[model samples]
Target: MGKVGPPITGLPVMPSDLPLDEVPEDVLREVLEEEKRIYRNRSYKKKPYPTSRDVMEAVREALRVSTRIHPDEFPDVVLHILESKGFEVRHVTVKRIWRAYETLVRKGVIRDELGVMM
Candidate 1:
């Protein structure tokens, strides 16, 4: 009968050498071309922004309230209050509110909060 060996033991061995510092030229070129193709496809596409009716209604409410109150006087506070009142006023939902806030800031409705437009 052939000699039998004992079961393997201890931790597995690892490679002693490090990988290449940079990708090979051909591979890099292929990656770059793929990225360019993806960019071109995305650029040609007309991506739509958020435009929910509930969000629009929230924006209208903000606009109506903003007209009477100074936007800068307390933009965050006012928004918080409206949110507390259950306006569903999320940054995502109130994109129009952000736009109106920016307009209000430009029109002196509120001081520029960190100069953020939205």
Candidate 2:
């Protein structure tokens, strides 16, 4: 009878101890590309994340509710007040809020000092 080898353990596991350079170039590139794609998608999703329209609405509501306090008195404070007013504060990111203020000021929708637009 022919000599038989001992039963083999399921497929040999890749040793993590081995240096990465030994891995094939194609394998390495595939892994790197996968990671790059994930990052790229994440960034793309975040681009234009905060829209100007949402900020405008938030500013409008904030000012409308806080009639006694001026919008220019404390911008950040007004933001918190607006949030408490039940406005979707998440839509009003810092960048968006700033843009909204700039647009309102430019278009004369709201004044910087008068507290309300003319």
Candidate 3:
């Protein structure tokens, strides 16, 4: 009877080490061309910055949905929601939103109750 042995695990065989500069010229040219093609097809997209109106709307929405959330945590939550919505809102933009909210409250456009704007 043949001796039993552990089953072979077909792990991926890595390519043998070969420095790029030492590779054949044809293969190196093909690699460089592939890299260039990949770079050409890549998207360098940027998120659009939210306008003042967008910021105000987001802040209002955040306030409406955050009744159970603490007032001190509102800014971070609002920033996250806005960013997830594809708005390029930053930490500074949170301050802008707060200022806008304050203005709205001062002008009686929005009512403030216990730090949560309504």
Candidate 4:
């Protein structure tokens, strides 16, 4: 809350001020200790985020089923499938999956645009 370094013209004071050599040892030490405290509170790799590969897997899974599905129903099915499988399904994720689905359809990865197996 207090001013950290020399108050120049209109610049806000921070621990790592312009003159690296001029900033006092105590201020640098404070910043280091703060950083350490923040690091200590983190959950390191405990709950990792889903990667693009995971989303691709979900997209493939959603479209690979034998049943016929309409393009309009893709988002709901994708959400259900991915969420049930423990992927963090967001709006953007569903959009990505839909685009991937369309891409696969265009490239003949999926047999039909309407999602029919035949």
lDDT against the true structure, each candidate: 0.53, 0.62, 0.72, 0.66
User: Which runs in model 2 stand beyond 4 Å of their true positions?
Assistant: 1-50, 70-74, 81-95, 114-118
lDDT of 1: 0.53
User: In angstroms, how far off is 77's CA in candidate 2?
Assistant: 4.9
For 38-118, candidate 3 gives per-residue lDDT tens digits of: 998896798888877777777778878776777678778778778878977654455686787787788886677436554
Roughly what TM-score does model 1 have, to 2 decimal places? 0.27
Give me the overall lDDT of model 2: 0.62
Per-candidate TM-scores read: 0.27, 0.36, 0.71, 0.45
Pick out the ten consecutive residues of candidate 2 with the lowest summed lDDT.
44-53
- Which ranking of candidates, highest TM-score first? 3, 4, 2, 1
Q: Write down the RMSD of all candidates, one decimal each.
A: 12.7, 10.2, 7.9, 9.0
Q: Tell me, by lDDT, which candidate is best.
A: 3
Better of 3 and 4 by TM-score: 3
Residue clash pairs of candidate 4: none
Task: Summarize candidate 4's per-residue lDDT along 1-118 as a digit string, tens digits.
Answer: 3435557687786645555666689988999999999989884653335665666666678667726777678777776776777656554455676666666667766656464333
Query: Best to worst by lDDT, what's the order?
Result: 3, 4, 2, 1
Tens-digit lDDT track for model 2 on 12-60? Answer: 5444535655779998899999999998887743223324565576677
**lDDT per residue (tens digit) for residues 2-97 in model 1:** 333443675453322324444489987898999999998877543233344443344455555655554454346545645555554455424455
